[model samples]
Target: MTVKTRIYLVRHGETAWNAGGKFQGHSDIPLSERGRKQAKALAERLSNLKIDAFYSSDLSRARETAGILAEPHRGTVYYLPELREINFGRWEGLTFKEIAEAYGELSTRWWASPLTIQIPAGESLQQVVDRCTRAVAGIITRHAGETVVVAAHGGVIRVIVGAALGLDLNHFWQLRLDNVSLTVLEYHGPEKAILELFNDTCHLHEK
Candidate 1:
């Protein structure tokens, strides 16, 4: 029987920037109280699953969310900078409207063709795809037939999913991943994988 490795791709809980519609990029913002509550709810949702490993962006938001999710299983989270969000460069704390006003057509062009345009000091979508995929590749190699949890930022998770499905990087924007959402990818081999779930936030339902 060919064993497939299942990866629970998660977006970190909400942050102040997230609530304010600011670009978090590589900013090291921590989760808010609501974000922590969201993480707790997600943790309860996955408490019964047999998770073999846990990975997360080195950012405090993702780190804290991973910590909460792993609390039930006694899992140690492997933090990686590569799993961090697309470096928004100089636009780290600005909203999209602010970016558009400040950057003019450049921002519009970037939104339309992210793969081709570089973000002033931030990373292009292609560059993000390269590094994030490399990191996930290593994780899949180490645990070929097991299940793992990868908690990261929304943009990072989108690119990883885009690459997995062989979609153009531009489509990354179209894939809307909610904070603390669950997205699963099952990999049977390096080139063979399946997106079992995407953006499942059913766990956030009112208690």
Candidate 2:
């Protein structure tokens, strides 16, 4: 019998750029006002869970969200730079429309087949997968049979969940993760994983 490892994957709360539909990429953007509220609500909802560890991306937005979520628990957060979002490079801070207008073909390819498209001077989907996988694998190995929380960017969360589902980089866009949303994944072993929950926002609905 194999022990089941559970991970509560959370996308950091919204940033000013996120609200504006701008590419945050690896930029160190802080959370907006609404994002802070969302994080508080999320913390309240997750306060009851028996989480053994808390991890977060080194970015400010993710780290801030993780701080709120960690308040009810041990109040400790381990930062992992590898869990940061896909580096959008030149595209960072640009809105969707601006990106499309500036880099037409590249933007089109990005939406159409993100796995095959690499942003100008930025990291590729394969790179994101590789690093995120190593970080996730390490987390699972260190805390086998326990539940842990990982607060990261939308792209990183999506990739991590996709990898856990055994999906390749091509299917990356299939999973959508909203800000402050919760996704639960259980790993039976390196080869066996299950998606118990995906993009759960019920906590945000609570008063």
Candidate 3:
């Protein structure tokens, strides 16, 4: 019998850029007012669970969300810069429409072939996956057999989910992670992993 490591993957609460449909890669943007409420609701929902440890992106949005979630669990949040969102370069703070209008084919090609095209002055998708994987690998190895919570950005979470499932990077973009949503990954050993839940936002609907 192999000991399992259950991971509660959480996307951070909404930020202004998220609401505005802007690319927030590595911007250190803080969450909006409603974002706090969303985090609180999720916190209340997970408060009863036996979350053994908490890890989060060092960005303010993810850090703050993880802090709220970790409050009732009585765990210190270990910040990981490697878990930060992909660097979008000049695309930061700009909407996709804006980027398209400005950069035209470059932006369009990026949306169509993200893995092949590199963003001007920014890190590539592969770079994002590399560092995020490094962070998650360390987290999983250190906390095996424990239920751990990882609060991070959507891009970061998507990278993790893609890596876990051995899915192609291009197809990984199809995964939609809403604000404060929870996805779970259960690892039965070094070779077997299962996605028990994905993008669950029921906790956000609490009265």
Candidate 4:
């Protein structure tokens, strides 16, 4: 039997910026009270899983969420900067409306063709796909046949899932990853990754 490695891809809990619909790209904001509660709920939801490894983006929000989820299993979370959200540069901390008001056509293009649109001084979606997928590849290789958890940003998780499904950067916005949502990916081999779950937020119902 071929061993399949399972990856539980979790988007970090809600943040103040998330509630405000502000761009939180690489901002290092801590989780809000609601976010903390959401993380704890998600932790409880996954407490029974046989997780072999835990990993997270180095950002505080993701790190804290991973910390919560790792508690039940007594696991150490491996922090990877490569899993950080796409850097929004000037767009960081701004709302979509604000971005549209400030950047006009550039912001429109960012929404329509994020794969090709560059954020003034931030990373393009392709760049996010490259770095985040590389970290995922490393995790899969390191923990083959084992179940691992990765807590990261919405944008980061989206790119990783899309990549696993052979979807390119153009479909970036299609993967709707909500805060504290859970996604599962099973890797049987390099080209045999299956998206078992996507954006599951049932645990948050307890909140």
Clashes of each: 0, 0, 0, 0
- Which lDDT tens digits does candidate 1 get at residues 1-207? 777999999999999999999999998999999999999999999999999999999999999999999999999999999999999899999999999999999898998999888998898888888889899999999999999999998999998888888998786788888999999999987677899999999999996
Candidates' TM-scores?
Answer: 0.98, 0.95, 0.96, 0.96
For model 3, how does the per-residue alpha-carbon lDDT over 1-207 read when each residue is reduced to its tens digit? Answer: 788999999999999999999999888999999999999999999998998999999999999999999999788999999999889999999998899899998887887777668999888788888898788778778988999999998988888888888988866679988999999999876456889999999987745
Error of 1 at 34 (Å): 0.3
Best by TM-score: 1
lDDT of 4 by residue, 21-128 (tens): 999998999999999999999999999989999999999999999999999999999999999999999999999899999999998888888987899889889889
**Which residues of candidate 2, in runs, are more than 4 Å off?**
none
Tell me the lDDT of model 3 at 188: 78
**In candidate 4, how many Å is residue 167 off?**
1.7
Between candidates 2 and 4, the one scoring higher on TM-score is 4
Q: Rate the local accuracy (lDDT) of all candidates.
A: 0.93, 0.89, 0.90, 0.91
Write out the backbone clash pairs for model 4.
Answer: none
Q: Whole-model lDDT, candidate 1? A: 0.93
C-alpha lDDT (0 to 100) for residue 75 of candidate 1:
93
Scored by lDDT, the top model is 1
Worst 10 residues of 4 by lDDT: 166-175
Rank candidates, lDDT, best first.
Answer: 1, 4, 3, 2
Give me the runs in candidate 3 sitting further than 4 Å from their true place: none
lDDT of 2 by residue, 1-207 (tens): 998999998999998899899999998999999999999999999999898999999999999999999999966999999999999999999998899899998888888777767889998788888899899989989999999999998889888778777677676777788999999889997667899999999988845
